[model samples]
Target: MKPSFLASLLLAAVLGAGGSILLTHASPAQAQTSTASTDTVTIFVDATFGFRKKHMATQLTKTHAEYAARGYRYVDMAPYNENGDLVGFFVTYSKQ
Candidate 1:
């Protein structure tokens, strides 16, 4: 192996690792602002399976009532799929 080739490989590895670390880790100021802005937002997973399928309606009704009592309102829901089938939903709620 040539010395120049080995140096280039080492430099490439260091730069790649540094770039990934910088992208994944949040800075202190960003973390603080994100937490403060999202304080009024909450997420919940409502999963429906064979065992709980029968009571899904009533369960959702109670969930709505409970959150409403605490001032959180339903904002949006996205399907949570497994493989190619629907499994549950990612529900978002917000309190203002």
Candidate 2:
């Protein structure tokens, strides 16, 4: 192999490894702050195949109440599908 080619490959490998190490050593607090900056409250809910609309409504209400009790302002509700027969929901909130 040519000397210049081998040097370039070694430099690239070193840079990639350094970048990965930096990311891995990042502080958890920094990560949390970054995530919090994107949104205030994050709720994750999952229900089984037989979960009814009413059940979801009730669960959402309760989740809202809990957030309210914690002095969080309600933002939005996002729903998603989990697996094949489970439904997932997210209730966003922000500190008041």
Candidate 3:
């Protein structure tokens, strides 16, 4: 092969390798995000009786406060009851 042909081949190989390195280094911003998992869970708070209702209120407040500090938010909620009385609340929390 000619000397010029060899030089061009080497130049192309070098440029390809350099481009690969640059691409690897260029995407660091994407890697900096979200090592923590996005997750979901449902918590059941019972409000069966007068004392239970009070306890459930405090517990729901405390649970929300705890999860909020850890980047969790309410996704959905359902109130469960028998007849006209409150039975429980199912609160869905998500961290995204």
TM-score of each: 0.48, 0.50, 0.50
Q: Candidate 1: how large is its RMSD?
A: 10.1
lDDT of 2: 0.62
Residue 74, model 1: Cα distance from true site in angstroms: 1.1
By TM-score, the better pick of 1 and 2 is: 2
Best by lDDT, which number?
3
Cα lDDT for residue 79, candidate 2: 72
Model 3 regions lying over 4 Å from their true place:
1-37, 49-52
Residue pairs clashing, model 2: none
Q: How close to the true structure is residue 16 of candidate 2, measured as C-alpha lDDT?
A: 90
Model 2, poorest ten-residue lDDT window? 25-34
lDDT of 3 at 51: 36
lDDT string, candidate 1, 1-96, tens digits:
999999999999999989855543322111111255554444433444343545646755776687688887787766656566544455566664
* Residue 11's lDDT in candidate 2: 100
Tens digits of per-residue lDDT for model 3 on 1-96? 999999999999999989855543342111112335667767666565343466776877887898799888888878876567776677877885
lDDT of 2 by residue, 49-82 (tens): 2445457667668778887898878877667553
